[model samples]
Target: MPGNDVRFLLVDDIRENLVALEALLRRDGLEIHTAQSAAQALELMLVNDYALAFLDVHMPETDGYELAELMRGAERTRRLPIIFVTAADMDETRRFRGYEAGAVDFIFKPIDPVILKSKSEVFFQLGCQARDLARQRDEMRAMALHRDQAMARLKAHADNSPLATVELDCDLNLRVWSQGAERIFGHKTRDMLGRPVAGTRWLSEETIHLLRGWIADDEGQDSAPRYTTEAIAFHAGGHEIACELYASSLCEPEGQHRSLTLQVLDISERRQAEAMRSLLIGELNHRIKNTLANVQAIARQTLRQSTGLEDFDRSFSGRLQALSRAHSILSDATWSSAPLDDLIADQIKAGTLDGDRLRQSGPKVQISPENMLRLALTLHELGTNAQKYGALSRSGGEVHLSWRCEGEGLVLQWQERGGPHVTPPVRTGFGHTLIGASAGGQDGSVDVDWQPEGVIWTIRLTQGVTPVSGDAPVQKALTSVTVTEESLVGRRILMIEDEPLVALDLTFELEDVGAEVVAVARTLRDALREAADQMVDLALLDGNLGGEKVDAVAEILSRRGIPFCFVSGYGPEHLPAGFRTVPIVQKPVDPARLLSVLHQISVTPVAETL
Candidate 1:
């Protein structure tokens, strides 16, 4: 009824009758394409999309009945609505033939306009509704296909994810289960589908009761919502596994209930890790307390047994402090790993080197915490020997320590020079037996070369050292800074820093050296703005800022032919990709060191800038 305007095709041999029918339907906006003969009417049918056709039965050639039969034979127009306008005198046999030719209705001649208008309107509304319904059906089919594809993608991700997933209906029947569920629960989906969840035997009684209670409370509610619970479940192999279950209710349109979806995940490993972490904390506390008590006992007994205060201080206090330093080194490494250089530094500070007498030179290397403790004791004994008769005893004498990576291992050399003349002792001391025996026990070898110049000791170790990779290339420090006569006075440098303190410190340091700090940007937004507007000669960038990386700034500066350097606390191994070619200075940088790096960049040729 909403779109009731019908388009009609009127065919007749007389033009006067077509005009009379058109006048009657003029108020309904009927579009009438009229034809003088049936042959012309058939031609009009070929080109137009008409809802209804009115024909005159008593034509000379190709009468209305014949034309209707022809129209019925055409595949394109076979279903078109046709009504005959004829004289009442037509016989019953001719009427039967008209019906057989696909005439929907017949009108007597002198053609009543009122009957014609009403019949045409009905067919037009029906045609419009049928077309609308067809379009709606096509749209619904496309939407269903798109929704199916989305559901398929979601199912694929759920199956592939590490977290286990399972779906169950309101009656607790298993519906959908993912491969991850099989791995976590050790149950195959084929054996579990359509089975009651409580009968699975893997679900604990407590978890089953919780699920039942939640469902019972939400009963009779059309808007079935989501809920979550965590509990322990048993695996197929009879192991108790902690799992977190995410459950949600599925419903059809019009608020009708369908089923429930459950996602199960095994959290057993995480739970066990938490429990073990608690035990480790308690154990660490007990060990530290016991170690302190042992040290106290040793100190009191050694002091009481000594003849004088000097002997008590040398034997009891110093040795306990040396042991304490070893413990500190182990603690700093989180009891997982330690740097050999750090262990050596800590031990030397406790005994002979006293900070000023220590001279360490080596590439960075990591050692296990267990080996670090053993090496700390060995080094403490060596330092004691040095303090008594070696280089550490004299003011000018010092220990020259160096280590390097060998084939699949590490070799550390500790040589003493400029102290007492060296010679092999006739009798091995307690320290000599411990160092030599411990090194050999760990599948390592120690060599003591008593040269006339000094005591040269080399230890080769096979374990607890990590070889440097390509990402962390070796960088040797310059022995001293080389300065030029040319001053960097009045040269402008752009400072891109995130921290206010570091930026302020750099600004002061740069101004002190006769260089102007043109602009300081604390974020990428501000830096880009300054770069676009200001004439920046050089840029000093921090690698990480608030949610933005410094690579973009570097790229912008590079394109503009402005030189820049990266100042970061991260090691060379952690630097951003493509930043290897860019110059970098590690932080906690000395003012003089920063100045030297900036000066080098300023003097570098333009072609060499990265």
Candidate 2:
């Protein structure tokens, strides 16, 4: 829009002549103005530029020659092209007069239309070229300004960046060192510049040798060939730092290597942080496994101890809740050892002890996590018995619980008073076994005295307070299913179990009985693969494989005419409808019955065997 529009001038005494000229030169961008006299033309010329002007030579007042001379006299209009037009015959005097008046050319009328148009187009093209040159000049200035700003920004980034940049020449001499390099290496740029790279010791011996090998070999690479790798280097202050380096040649046009750039980034902090995180994660995993093993033990013992689901819900739930409380305290300390006071305080603070009726006094004794869990559970049981039957049941009752670490071991005494007469239980129970474990390791001992006035319990377990190495005792519940090794002889089993503990037990028991296990699948996909890909005989499938039902696996086995049964803790209805006759052994299954079922399915008549 700005570059369009060229102004034009036409000076003629006759209106017809002006109209004819305007029509010939008229175009979308040309703005042709007509003047009837030289005085009016002068007025138009004073206001605007004209790329080309057509002036009539003969006039009564101030002729074309005079007007052209006047335009040449003005500063702004001097470059304006004047073309003189005449109906008169060519004469030397007239041409001489026009040339003397600064006219560019003279045209004799009637005009040759082609020459007239061609002559005008030349001046128009010149005007466009002049405008383009001016625009180009302005653009070059803007580019220079931007280049300066960019250079300043690059300088600032290099100064503030954390990564080090070093330039080394072909002779292995440090040619340049950036401000970032100075900051990271704890050395000034002046101290590093022009120094020998090999002597710097920043590059390890192995890394230096690797770099040298790369440099010595000519791989005939393209422009900007480079190598990047991570290695360990020493800081200026004598500490190991992990650095990532990028090396490239600063070559000449002939393709000979001249120098290299080592863009070093320090990653020591990041790697250290990652290592610490990994250690913490591994510790957390170990603790979680321990907790899970404890839970498994509690579940089995609770089930064995209870009469029915209602009794289990009433009794076992409370016991597990007690264990959960102990876990919470340990978890708060990141499963590390907690003080003895906090261990015992957790039960009483959780409403086991009436705030006004319990008295506690013990020197601060630090207990390991393994002993802490057992001790917490024991205190919980004692408090439960006290509230239900002993001292805490009565308003006038009280409990004085204390512990002191002596030369023999840490001795804990629990004494209760002012309650109904106490009677000894007929036989030992799970609660006694759990409390007994608190005194020492799994082999710890507990002593209980039932007096008419109240009850007294003494525990001895301090020497073996370190962390437990093996699993809980009740985890051995799976061993109750007994089978002779010869019972399952020559049986081929495919085990599909997701639970690791259950899988371990099944593998161990089945292998002990001389079964040749063909495959063990942990996922439904794996089960399907085993069914389709492997030779499976008498498959054992869990009801759930990682949260998904093993419907597809079951269908595959059934369709293949394979004798497969399910071993799960679920009801028979949980299985697919097609295999109604397939025996489903509920979990905690007797190994003898499982073996018997496999024996029955694998049996063949004498005629069929032949």
Candidate 3:
């Protein structure tokens, strides 16, 4: 709305000439004003801004040249462009006179319409451009004012923030120190400004060295704009604080260091939380591996006692369900402890035992997670036995389950009544073995009384009970598995693992296939030494050895041209980027898969294996 101010002036004594010029120049975004006399033209020019004006040379009162000279004398119309229309033949002397009178150009009596429109269009475009430039200048001034206000607000916020804001020069002299830095480091801003940072008490010597190294390395290099690092800083009270520093630097065009801005955030609480999360993850990993090992043991034992596939399915599934139920209870309590009554109640509900025919009594007692698993399995075995051949087999049968604390120990009794006569077993079975194993790894005893009416089982534990290791010995008929590959026989192998039970199980599996284990290294130190010193044809490398990555050992084995495979509790993401192509076996290790991988490694060429 503000830029549409284009107007043109045409002055002539002849009405026909003025009409013709107006018709030629008339178009959109322009206003044409016509004046029949010099006086009228001068008055029109005084009121309205004009882009261009045309004058006739033979006006009655004032000629075109005199009108041009008069317009040039005026303040508003001096810079305006003027063209003259004349019929008389012009000599060099007359042309010079017209030029001196401020006439820019002269058009003949018969004017060309093309010339008139093109010349007027140029002046119209120039007017539009001037308006646009003026508008842009005003907008830029407004933006500058807003930017100054925003910078002021940002400075106030930085000064009051909890994070320490620091500005340093190329020589590491403090240039700007906010109030936050004063509060955190016990130094006034006025005192800290213009001081060298090397003598500051807030930063330790080691931290200063680290920061200086970063700055020096980046000084003359085409470095990134910003960087982040962690450091141990001291508080005003002399207490230690973990600080996370974010730094950005300004540089000259030639890569010379200029200035730097640093924002230091106290991350002590975040660091503690990260450490706790890591500990919880490691503990969870340990427990999961143990659980898998226990499952393997249960499957193996179940297989040994099973008479057929159907019997194995029934027994193994029931045992696993019982274990799952115990895990559920532990999970609900965050794996800290499980109440004995809750365990018994869940078992009774799962076993579908009649509550009216049972007498159950026990004080509130908390058991460890591992012991709860063992107790759950023991209860499953007893319930299955009772439903099959013991008291629960008859309608009139009854069971009495009671427990009480005895001097820092606990004693639980399971008795059966109102059933057929009982006799002692000639040999122990899987049920008997599991029930006996309920004593766990503590000082405990299992006693049974084979009365004429029924049987009674009493379990007493002298200390906190823990589930037995999966590698524990058991007296049972052994099942043999035939070796699938003859290449594995008599081949030497090196094993790198930390868990004793897992290593032992692997050792037995390798031995069963006639492969000799040359060395078993549990730590990174031992693993590196064994890998370099041993002359084994192949190696079994675990991805993690006692919380240290085994990438170094893998590299050594690769350099020696030894074929190898990895066994890890974690997935491929845990593997080193360089050794991701190597074969990996995850826990709990499958005997067949481990053997298959070993056979492949033994037979394949070292170049291909690597």
Candidate 4:
């Protein structure tokens, strides 16, 4: 009790000695607990922790020496301080034995209370200091652990970052260079580290002087060495590189001086991109100016060749606007490529149109800008021709456009109906030649079908006629054939879907087949819980549940001896490898088809389950 605080334990064979010891040591901030005999002391020790044990050496059954030996043997009281209270004069051997039994000091009977209080006070102070020291050590250790973690994270980021980085000291000595630095500079760390920065033949004297000045000003005068600077440095191969330098100080504990930390970054690729961007901007400006001049010349030529002012105005504005729309479509795709659907949409939207009289539907397909521009011009000519003499000129006419994949190519159909009857033109014009010749050059075939009801055209071309990549052809294979509801009767299922509506629909379908919906889960967490908690026979998992990967949930059910299937809107390629082995039911699923698959999976042995 006299350890951490000024609380003392008083033990004596006589009650008189305990009372005298308590009277002497009792103070404003001191606490004392007294025990009459060694047995009572040992009982107190078993129940509570004592800072010090004062014991009478002379006793009837068990003495202070024996109690001290027992205290040292018990784990709880082993480290406790014991002082012998004796009337007899103990020899050097007895004092040594008392110390061996874990006594801190010895006190004579008929004691001096002042000496007793003073000795107890010293032990209390020592205990308090020891506890404080232990707490400080724990705080230091926690701080050290936090610092280590921060340093490790910073090191990992620097090593893995794409940007090249290097560090140099104030004395122009190479200190640190990340893996990116080696990739960009083409210099090994072993060749550069601990070497003079100038030896690399990359750092210019001007750059070094600028760096030194910054370090001295920030680190010396202001006591803060943190700055960012950009310059040109040479790579190991002597190629000029754009670079940014960041410098900071590593100060010692005393804060008298500092070590410089220079973070060097190579931004050559960024600079090159900027230069190329400027060149592209200039090229675009030149093309635009030339196009504008060409439009002006075309307008002049059209006016000269026209039979009347109305004809001249109509022909000039229409052709120029068509050219403008083509240019706009090309610009939107960064002049790389454009979607075929998008090019057609832009052409139709920009040209004369009756929105209610036209409908367009097609599979998504991308086309190169070169092909798109020519295609746009062709479409514009066709739309203009229709407006002048075809269905578009009529009040209640309509045009329907659609496209579909045919083998390795695309077949686009343009049909006009609900218009005045049409007849074939006597002669082909410049517009017809432009549309025909342009498409022909791209391995495309166009057929103009002039019908009595309206005109129709069909264009067939390879999917990737342009310089754009085409999406993989979607293959819908019949994994299983349609089956009757009676085939699925009495089948059991474990439905795992996150959507409430989807789950309800699936349950209804299962019930329609005279089958049972054994269990349903809304999340991967819930699904896993159910798989472990329920007796699942068959599982139907949604491919994505609240953004969690459903494959893991499927794996859980599979491991638990359950047959499972995946339900997803995504294509087969979107699934993980070998996931195809697991049957996939595409969304907007047929109730009868789902029942058939569920029946198949329910009867399938767990050994064959995926």
Q: Which candidate achieves the best lDDT against the true structure?
A: 3
Off by over 4 Å in 4: 1-7, 13-16, 28-51, 73-80, 88-104, 149-167, 176-193, 200-206, 216-219, 232-241, 249-258, 264-273, 328-334, 337-610
In model 4, the clashing pairs are 1-7, 1-50, 1-51
State, as a TM-score between 0 and 1, how close model 2 is to the true structure: 0.49
| The best candidate in terms of TM-score | 1
Per-residue error for 200 in candidate 3, Å, reads 5.2
Instruction: Kindly list the per-residue Cα lDDT of model 4 for residues 1-610, writing each as its tens digit.
Output: 4344444677877888888888877775455788877888888878765556787878878877888899889899888888888888889998988888788899886788778878888877765665677679888999999999998888888777766666666576888877877877788888889987777776788887886776566544445657788988887888888889777766556663345676677777788999999999998898778777766766776666668987776676566666666665566666766777666655545435445566776666766655665566667777777788878788877777777766666677878887778888787766676667665336778888889998888877664544234564322211213333346566567787888998998898677667788888888788878777777567787877788777677667777877877876655566655567777765645454466667677777867755
List the candidates ranked by TM-score, beginning with the highest.
1, 4, 2, 3
lDDT of 2 at 61: 81
Model 1: lDDT to the true structure? 0.74
Model 3 weakest lDDT span, ten residues long: 473-482
**TM-score per model over all chains:** 0.55, 0.49, 0.47, 0.52
Q: How do the residues 97-193 of candidate 2 rate in per-residue lDDT, one tens digit apiece?
A: 8988888898889988889889988887876776667679889889988998998897788788887878876677888788988888787887778
Rank ordering of all candidates by lDDT, starting from the highest: 3, 2, 1, 4
Provide backbone clash counts, one per model: 0, 1, 0, 3
Off by over 4 Å in 2: 1-148, 217-220, 303-313, 334-351, 354-356, 362-368, 393-395, 403-412, 420-426, 439-453, 457-610
Candidate 4 local distance difference test against the native: 0.72
Candidate 1 Cα RMSD after full superposition onto the native fold (Å):
10.6
Query: Per-residue lDDT tens digits of candidate 1, residues 198-312?
Result: 9999688888787776666665465667888888888889988888888777775656455667777778888899999999999889877866775676577666656788777
**CA RMSD per model (angstroms):** 10.6, 14.5, 16.6, 18.7
